[model samples]
Target: MPASDALEGIQACVFDAYGTLFDVHSAIGKHQHRLGGRADQISLLWRTKQLEYTWIRSLMGLHADFWKVTQDALDFALDRHGINDPELRADLMEAYLKLDCYPEVPEVLSMLKDGGFRLAILSNGTPAMLEAAVKNSNIEQFIEKNFSVEEVGIFKPDFRVYQIAVDGLGIRPEQIVFLSSNAWDAHGAAAFGFKVTWVNRFGQSKERLPGKPHFTIANLLELPNLLG
Candidate 1:
């Protein structure tokens, strides 16, 4: 639990889509039997490479939408694991579009919405990808906007990427409560000046980064209480 004084003057709640609100591993979980013993490893590698590609591409000035990056990452993971089935690859990619929300997501978002805070998602996902996931998870009404990196042609950790939330919400960075399950993303949002909360769902260690989160909570269930 966070100290009571941590979050203050929060006008909006901006969340990272994957891992924060949605279960990024749910796609792989659906095919666990088929993936067999390599399921966990492939999923982990896929996610790692997915984020790595985004950062690398951002630095190289060769931006691709998250969908493409996800596909490429899945390909790499599959190849590395010696699973070369085209049907399985396609199924995994399709599954990414409909990833499940974390069990407490809807309840937490509703609580925040009932509390009168504006809500939005600032994600590396494309508009289409975000839309499908939000709609699939039935959380569309809770989100006012889905801010994608496509608008800026860059992935996250980029200062410009964080600016989308500020610009879209028409608020100062300090007024927004940014939440992300990724430690690096929490640090990035913090560096960009948002009042950050690292939703440390997987118990990841805090990154040694320029910015530090004001609070760290195990899950979104702790969010409404913290904000209040």
Candidate 2:
């Protein structure tokens, strides 16, 4: 889709961090010896459990920051795959803080900034994690703010998490463009009444959820055109 009036009235852009702008698997790819042939499954499980923990914790009213949830999920994945090494765990955690950003992120973010839209990262990541990842990826110059679930001590697909953007940006929900690689996140944002763009990087099917995105694109590069 090309840029059009469909993006009219958008004053801010809020993005999900993990699996969206950053390659969540890049951290595991750096540790081939530890993961070996199970790298893919282990990576998938780590992410799956990470998200599951967030939702479960939210529902149980027992909240932990995303960093802790991430570590817990990583531990589960490591144990499930029969890989046990304290040093490996440490390395993986550190790698996560500096996850490799997608090649198109920097340019796309710059383009958005140049287009005069306010930009922020609203993520399930903690403030420290988001700060480190943004700085490490050299996108700090483009983003205007970072919003973390830590502020409310909850994970996402929750209305409260998405509320941070509307509240923080001082803009109406209809005026913000929320983007995510995860379909659930897109659905959540759409339900919250924000215009949403699902960056369907993996060619996943549309979710059968309450809210649907306004647009679906293959990557961040397509975002600029969609916003035009």
Model 2 steric clash pairs = 3-225, 3-228, 4-228
Model 2 regions lying over 4 Å from their true place: 1-3
lDDT of 2 at 12: 90
Query: Which sections of candidate 1 miss by over 4 Å?
Result: 1-6
Where is model 2 poorest over a 10-residue stretch in terms of lDDT? 1-10
Clashing pairs in 1: none
Candidate 2 lDDT tens digits, 114-156: 9998999999998999999999999999999999988788889
Give the backbone clash total of model 2: 3
Superposition TM-score, candidate 1 onto the true structure:
0.97
Q: In order, what lDDT does every prediction score?
A: 0.93, 0.92
